[model samples]
Target chain A: MASETKLSHTTALILHALDAGLVYGFSVMEMTGLPSGTVYPALRRLERDELICSQWERQSIADAEQRPARKYYKLTVAGRATLEASRRRYPLLERLIPTVEAKQV
Target chain B: MTARVDMVVRAFQRGFLSCISLLVPSGQRAEWRREWQAELWHVRRACAPAGAVSWQAEREVTAFCLGAFQDALCLRLHAPKNEPRIALLHGSALQCLLFLGGVLAASYGLTLLLPGVRVESHPERYQVRSGLIMIQDEAYSNDWVAATIPVERFRDWETTRQRYFDGLAFYRIGEQAVSAGSHGTGGWEVAEASKNLFSLLGLPVRFASQEGEADAGLPQAILSDAVWKREFGGDPRVVGSVLRVGGRDVRIAGVAAEGGWRLPGKADVWLLERDSEIAAGGRGHVVAHLTNQGRSEMWASYVHIDAYSPDEPGDNLCGFSFEERTRGPWGIYQFTVLLAFLALPAITTVSMGEYSVSSHRPSWSRRLCRWGYMGAKIALLLPIVYFLSLDVAYWHTTLYSLASEYAQLAASFSICLFGLRWALLDQRQRCPVCLRHVTNPARVGLASRTFLAWNGTELMCTAGHTLLHVPGLPTSWFSTQRWLYLDTSWEFLFTGSGVG
Candidate 1:
């Protein structure tokens, strides 16, 4: 079944990337074509009000060239509940929303 | 969920910590910083989530929130560590308080240890400017013998009696009266009959020799200590120096010690009995002797002349008994003591009232303790001040009385000091409830009906409020209370508080 959730254009893009596990700031920015200014500040505000949380990922490959430490943002329980509530309020938008692509753009 | 909650809680903790900086001024920024940092640590622990995710995100959220809250809350953008920094800024104020405390301690210590403070007592030197009379004459006995002569006639003496004799005045004599022409009777009867007449003229009878010879010559002269010392250098040589006194030569038989009389220090030269009789008629001689001796004997049988001149009559010129003289001087002492005693309690109540008014703003316990301390201080200080005031009053009355101007001036100064102490104490210990100045009725009534009803004038009451340091209020209240207690106690013991 298609996921019955619809977000705003920017929100939708952010959510789509987070759901696919491409949650780091750089990864989200690269996938959604959003600038660092728009992504970073929004991430911070969301995290502040309990809607989101961010953390650094542990490096798995010791030899991998060190990429700038990426902060991974994820929806909190309250944020998930809000997403669900919004889906119920706008069922028609949920139906017309496009599916998130699995591959990185 | 719990981990996310913990993170949010840590963020809010940082915000709250940062908010404290807003409460203090920029100068106190360092103090606020330390205070808030400690406070935030407590808050973070209290808000820590109970799960694995909480452990993972707590530190990051804490740091990030700390930065964000600092930015939002700090008014001055350039300021760093605003909350923590402000918490450390109390160094100067604390130092100032410590300095003041040290100074107070040192002053208190010095006051306790120092004996340099002089205890009030009788003045050593009396300025003699009033209450003195001088008689410039000489006298002789009825036998027509040159019994005494003025110092101006020293060359006429039969011998160098001045080398071994001093002059003297006679006021009284006692012997059985003998009718005229009695047989085998000695000259004692003559001396006895003349005693009453001489006493009425304020004069004293003197023995011509140690053998109490009734027929001895009457010498009349008084010498001051200063003259005696200058002439004899305090040696025995001057005791018998034959010198002219009041133009009559007299033997300096003996030296009279200083301060032998109550008269002001003015009379030093005396005339002989023969010279006195010559200058003043027999009637005048008798009258002068009676007056000089304070007229203590029968006046009807003796000669009596007014000691005061017709134009200027001095106080108590009429002969007064020792008791009567005491009464006059004692009146002044009584008045001083009365004022001092009354002022004592009045001053205490006012001072307490002032303290209460000023200290009301402190914590309840602190205020109560402060009031108690002030009360104790007043109580402790009262006896000291009372003794001091009494001493001052007594000396001023007895010693300064020699100089009317000095005596009056001293009396005035004492009264003014008592009044000033009263006003001051009233200002210091003000009532807590009324918040009015202790001495001022419009702001704070000086006399309360309830207080008066309870005979509270004797007992100091805390009443309305604590004392305040603000201007236009009594600044001397505390000191006044201390002085009042002392003055009152002293007056009670020394003067007797029948009036207060």
Candidate 2:
């Protein structure tokens, strides 16, 4: 049902960022150049609409890194199908956000 | 920058986010706050890494924290409404009782604003002055409406009956063309009474006095409250003005207080007359103050006009017969409400279905709570019917008219019967244990298959306590609605939603 509906540009950006391995809310905001307010709420909507899913990283991992545990997002199967449809609707979406490996390298 | 300044700036950013968290709904506030706080930590680290203080980086963090307010606002706006609180008030037992109490309180408050209805509800204030009796001719003794003693007979009785009475006041109810100052002439009901009538009755003067006393002029007139409002536009200036009644210019003394207890007839104006010849010429109702012996004699005799006999002990002929002619408005309302409640079972089913003492039966406390709720609804409804009926009866008129009493009776019966019927029907639809109205009705089986099997609408208690089967048609096997208790095995159906 959620896959059938059209995704907004900001929502599609967050979904595309999640698909490209920019998983955390801050990473999505950085990649999309959207503010923290726009990225976080759009991520929440995608998660609620079942286009994306979220889980907190292990507390030990955050303690090893000496920072708070980050909530990471991953695209569901339905979300990947919806992203394919959104990619057709907004052709510049893939060019808008780069892959995590590409940005790091 | 100093360490304290950096610490203060970091604290302000976190404090702003904390304030924004309040906008989110309480159920999801903690998770929403944690998510935002975690992201904020990462953002601050990326902006100013390695314990460095950069103004641009601090400004970016501040702007990042401000975005939380919008996110928090969006979550708050989209949060599901508090469904349980709304369901608790919709058709719940507590809501029914509250609605009845609210309307009852409003009706009582309205009665305080209406003088006629207030006096009717509390009849002690309008009790006819003690020792006051009306005397009439023998021909008109049985009928107070047509009962009047000729002025000559009253004059003859005045000279002969000084030993039997203290004072006598005569009032003739008639209609005369009246005009006040610039107000046009209209036919107004007038009570032509002797100048000493107010004093003779030993009644306190209630009219508002301005220029002089109510008895300043020889032939002054006092306007009834209805007439004062209708003809004079309720002006205080009209008190001192002249009013022409039947081609005679009479000074307006003052306006009478609003009252439902007008004796003889409902008059708009009391035209006081100084000329004894004119007052003593016409036939009119005479009120006489009776001494102790006169009172004893009046009560002891049934026929006092042409023949006085001490045979009757219970009947009094010359007392306030006009009030006794009909049950007052409040009396009629009380009787009608009682009759309506008595006839309630005939109109609708009164029995709350019988409960069985099985393993599935509710606890004794739960049963007591259900009965107590039913009793509270009925207790609140009684006064609601009373005050609302009187409110409808006396809202428009200042006097007790027969039509208003009839309206009160109709309102009383209609409101009481229908209100109680709805209350019972609502109770039947509610779950006995939790007192919440059952929801999600689904039809089971065809209506034509009722003879072969149970065919009715099945409704489940939202709390998963029981299922209600209301037959589409009442048969011998399913004469009334039945409640089927859901056992512990069925608890899985209500798991995640927190019902059972």
Candidate with top TM-score is: 2
Q: Identify the candidate with maximal lDDT.
A: 2
Please give, for residues A1-105, the per-residue lDDT of candidate 2 as tens digits: 356679888888888888875378888888889998798788778877888888888888889989888888888899989999999999998788876762210
lDDT of 1 by residue, B171-261 (tens): 2222222211212222221121122222232323222233212324545333344445554465554443455433335454444334323
Per-residue lDDT of B259 in model 1? 31
Chain A of candidate 1: what's the TM-score?
Answer: 0.60
Per-residue accuracy of model 2 over B54-126 as CA lDDT, tens digit each: 7788899999998898888888888888886675477567777777788888988998898768767645434
Q: Score the docking of each candidate (DockQ).
A: 0.02, 0.64
Model 1 spans with C-alpha error above 4 angstroms: A1-105, B1-215, B218-220, B271-278, B281-334, B340-401, B404-416, B419-500
**Model 1: residue B327 alpha-carbon error in angstroms:** 7.0
Supply the TM-score for candidate 1.
0.29
Among all candidates shown, the one with the greatest DockQ: 2
True contacts kept of 2: 0.86
Q: What is the CAPRI rating of model 2's predicted complex? A: medium
